[model samples]
Target: MTKIRALSEADLPAVGEIYAHYVTATAATFDETPPGLQEWRAKAEGIARAGLPFLVAEVDGEVAGYAYVAQYRPKPAYRHTLEDTIYLAPGRTGRGLGRLLLGELIAKLSGTRARTLVAVIADSGDPASARLHTAFGFEEAGRLKAVGFKHGRWIDTVLLQLDLTK
Candidate 1:
């Protein structure tokens, strides 16, 4: 059985590895290089310090995927908006884990002061992500054409938003 819970310091290595796969092997993320364990720990700590939600999905005590929300922008005007990031292990997609992770993350955020949740998807071809967000009531907000270049091609970012006020 898979379980969702708050991220822990022990999960950093697995989380970093899961994210490294996407960073190096896919356009799911535009990062050219993956951060080390220390970087992941520091980032997790910072997010926790900011009182945001950072979650992980564990299957039989193994980290299968993770998700988190961060301030959409550093400016005070954007305080009520948050951006989500979710990633699953290389072989973990299409198995309902994405939805589980994202669902739990969204539930945790609902009680917060955030009024909007945004998902900045890297590729339109990533239907699973689009579907996951859509399943959770996120609507397409906008699309930026060829805004990112990765894997020798220009990539478009699809922006989706969910109103938390409702």
Candidate 2:
């Protein structure tokens, strides 16, 4: 069975590996360089300090994926808004696990002060992500044109938003 749970400090290594795939292999994340262990832990620490939700999906006994919400910005006025991030291990995509992880995180975030949620996806042919977000009531906000470049080409970012207060 695949279960979703809050990510603990011990999960940071697995989470970092999943994130490193995007950092080194694709445009899913805009980060051009993958951070080291300490840097990644610091990222996790920042989320914990903000009282935000950080989650992971375990299938059987292995970490299959990770997801979390980070402060959209550092300013106080942006406290009510949080950005979503979901990363699945290689060979683990298209299994519907991403949707499950994201669903749980959104539900958990609803109980917090975060009233708005956003997903900035970089893939142009990513239908699974769009479908999952739309089914969960995340509207298509807009797409930024050529805001990033990865894999030797310009990439556009598709923005999706969900209003948790509704």
Candidate 3:
């Protein structure tokens, strides 16, 4: 069974481990190095302070994935816009876990102060992330070509957006 809940301090290590794999093996994220606990701590704190959620997915009691949103930009004028991020443990994709996490995220944020939820998907030749986001009603807002360099090649980013007010 899969469960979704608020992320806790105990889950940060697992979260880091999950993200590290992507950093080293794929361009799913632009981060070249896995952030330390302090960075993770700061991230959680920042999201919490913004009155948003840092959520985790537990599969049979194991921290299998996490999802969260942060302000799309630092300006107060953009406070109502957030960018969504979701990641799963190695060998944990294609089993509907991303759907669960994203569904819960959208459900939780609907009709709130968040007027928009954005997804910045790295175009690493894998369409999984884009497919997943579009399946959730996220529309293609834009794309930036060659904005990220990883795994010995240039990478583009596909921007998708969901209107929370809808």
Candidate 1, superposed: residue stretches over 4 Å from native: none
Candidate 3 lDDT (Cα, 0 to 1): 0.92
**lDDT of candidate 3 over 71-142, digit per residue (tens):** 999999998999999999998999998999999888888767899999999999889899999999999999
Q: How far out, in Å, is residue 120 in model 3?
A: 0.4
Against the true structure, what is each candidate's TM-score?
0.97, 0.93, 0.97
Which candidate, 2 or 3, would have the higher TM-score against the true structure? 3
Q: What are the runs in model 3 whose C-alpha is more than 4 Å off?
A: none
Off by over 4 Å in 2: none
Cα RMSD for candidates in order: 0.9, 1.3, 0.8
Clash totals for all candidate models: 0, 0, 0
